[model samples]
Target: MKVLLLVAALVVVGGGIGLVLVMKSAAGPEKQATKVETGDCVQLTGAGKEADAVKAACDNPQTPYVVSVKGTVKGDCPEGFYSYSVATPLRGEGVGLCLGINAQVGLCFDDIKTKTPPPLVNCSGARLKISEVFDKASYVNSPCKEGTEEVISYTAYGATQKFKSATICFVKP
Candidate 1:
């Protein structure tokens, strides 16, 4: 009787442990505890669809883009960092992507009359300048390099209040 009881207990405990291990493995990727900081490399997922941005190692080839700035506003990216914004079709919450400075990326004009946004290109070594328009508060708060010329300005509406956002375009010098 003692031997049978011991065997049964061991089996139950072992089965429970195995079940836990399997569950953890099935939970998908583990959530990142650390907040994404400046200069960290990230991969933008679901492009041209729904955006699901996540942090990735700098050397990871899958994550080619770097975080130049961290904020909720758009078009307020620091000089040299390309700013791109993605919003749901219904104008729900939007996410911003601040590509690394001097990183070869494409450009899309907000005013471009098109059913979809333009494709990205390798605009490296191009004679381009930055044009930005954002909320005054955001502009004043962000740590953008000084002497950034502001070509145009406009009001940006968000899901909630009419918060300001900017559209900084790179043009030929």
Candidate 2:
């Protein structure tokens, strides 16, 4: 009987320990903070500036994410309220390059009646695939007008790696 009791106790303890280990492993990688994904863009904060950040954000590099760009586009406002594509900047590493996305810019009218803004797409948390290249970069631009506002966003993985860092900026018309 004593031997039977000992065996039961051992089995229970082992089961508990096994359960704990399984839970921990299922949690996957640890992220400092939650990443935010909008249909057009993925933003990650607190990740390292390069490869480390890319890996941490993606948690999986095999998935490709489609990025959307929005904001006040430059040039005369469209016949009605509409958004257009700007230009995509080069993807490489160059210290002290130009500021702001090189693509077209968008402008939001403070007082205008139009279709309600569309739902923001969640494109965050995608992995940036990195080759063995040393430095890479990409650029995007917002349009400009005399009295317009420019806000832009780009969604892509490995941005922090190729560009060494990714930044979102507003250009005042």
Question: Please, what is the whole-model Cα lDDT of each candidate in the order they appear?
Answer: 0.45, 0.29
- Regions of candidate 2 where Cα sits further than 4 Å from its true position: 34-169
Task: Report the CA-based lDDT of candidate 2 relative to the real structure.
Answer: 0.29
Residue-level error in angstroms, candidate 1, position 164: 19
TM-score of 1: 0.36
| Model 2 per-residue lDDT tens digits across residues 69-123 | 2232243322222232222223222111111122211211232223222221222
Which candidate tops TM-score? 1
| Candidate 1 residue-wise lDDT, 1-173, digit = tens | 99999999999999999998787666433422124545566666565445545777655434545555555534575443556555433333455555542222233232222222223333453334443323332433543345643333223334543223434434543
Kindly report which residue pairs in candidate 1 clash with one another.
106-121, 131-168, 133-166
